[model samples]
Target: MSYRNTGTLFTVLVFLFATAGARAWAGSQSKLVAFTVDSVLAADTNKGIDVRIASMGARLRKVFSYTTYRLISRQRRRTQCGRMTGFDLPGGRILHVEPRTVVGDTIGMELVLFQGPRPVMTTELRLKRHAVLMIGGPHYEQGMLIIAITVDTPGSHDVLVHEPRIHQHQRLHAVSTPGQAP
Candidate 1:
């Protein structure tokens, strides 16, 4: 074959290889959108000591999708704790004085957050089997929690951790400090 013909063939091969590589990395964009609504809050409450409270409700839906490109064998895979927050409200707190209680194998996961007004928060945690999802409380202004999990399979897996129901309630009250009047 002529030099020009050889060069053309090489270019075509290179293009195909590059395109394949990109597609492999992205998995499937359409699939990803399927598993996108991981979690949602259907009920929330924000109440102060004044006996006044505001309430809200929310819904969490599946928000992500994945497909196996090569399966990577059927080996057991583990994932570290993964956590993401959708909101970080200031001056808000989580009202849970009781220590966390773990009942059974699948009955010990609780997360709650409260905001004053015009603000809300959401979080998402994607994990595999035998993994733990740790949820801390709102500390200072930007306190956060952690979620740890492990994947038991190597094939493509999708997880949707959603509440599908949340009600938010909050009360308005003036901050109490030294030299402050009610």
Candidate 2:
């Protein structure tokens, strides 16, 4: 083949390879969404936000207008799309998350907060991979509860160390603080 023909073929092959790589990455995106649920108590206890959520303290303060924000409990889970997953919050409430679809890099899901037998708040959310969403306003012991839901990075099913699987019955340690014994 001539040099011009060879150059044309090379350019075509490079374009094909790049397109294939992009498609492969999109195909490999998992159907799973990892959720990190943090239940925080917000009141005038003067403790401020806990270390785990201190990075978002400014947002919490501006929204909730509370003096203290303490993490009461945290739970993690990996749920599939079209399936509903529940997390137990303080004051005997349940926050249900149902992941629906992943379009591009955004994960869409529905969330429902249930108090006892009644459903309180039901809404849908679209979040980018690795973003945190906070939902609050449930009365608890001394203060209200602010629940933070963090969506892990896409295709992170392999690196989940502390998540509860929705399908299997596996035994795992409950989430604990740094200095506390598990």
Candidate 3:
């Protein structure tokens, strides 16, 4: 083959090899976000030690592409996994609040409370984490609602809690699984 033709062929082969290697390396890169739950129970003070007594329910509407909802009844065996036991909701909607899996580093959730057709209230929450997030919630009373979330991380993490800038009650706290101090 002519020298020019041979040189052109070598350049094309080199470019192909470089492109393939780059793609293989990118595939091995760690996922941008991941999640996990603690096998051991959190400390009594860190857990939902019945600090408050209340009942709340919501109908799950598929806004995001992926979400899992489980109904949990207080009467059932209350344990770590049993957190999502059982109850009931109108229109056959799931009632229990269980651990959820949200892909990507940022998770967005919206909940609305309806009393027969008329909308009573709505809530919007955002979660951003590098690891997994163990969440439990939908607790409510009168017009007050609370969502408890436990984040899972093998390393010490700084969680950012965002509320209105004008609100003084906005704050962030950390706790760990039972036995371990945060």
Writing each residue's lDDT as its tens digit, candidate 3 over 95-175 gives 232323333434443334444455454555455653222333223221112222322212225443322122233225545
Model 3, global lDDT: 0.32
Candidate 2: tens digits of C-alpha lDDT, residues 108-146: 899999897699999998986645577766677887777
* Span of ten consecutive residues with least summed lDDT in model 2: 160-169
lDDT of each: 0.27, 0.74, 0.32
Q: For residues 1-182, could you state the per-residue lDDT of candidate 1 as single tens digits? A: 99999999999999999999888544432111111111111111222111110110121111111110111111122221122112232344321111122212121212334455432344433333333332223233222221112222223353433233334433256455212111
Highest lDDT: give the candidate number: 2
Q: After superposition, how far is residue 12 of candidate 2 from its true place, in Å?
A: 27
* TM-score, one value per model: 0.28, 0.65, 0.23
Q: Which stretches of candidate 2 lie over 4 Å from their true place?
A: 1-30, 156-182
Which candidate achieves the best TM-score against the true structure?
A: 2
In candidate 1, which residue ranges exceed 4 Å CA deviation?
A: 28-130, 137-182
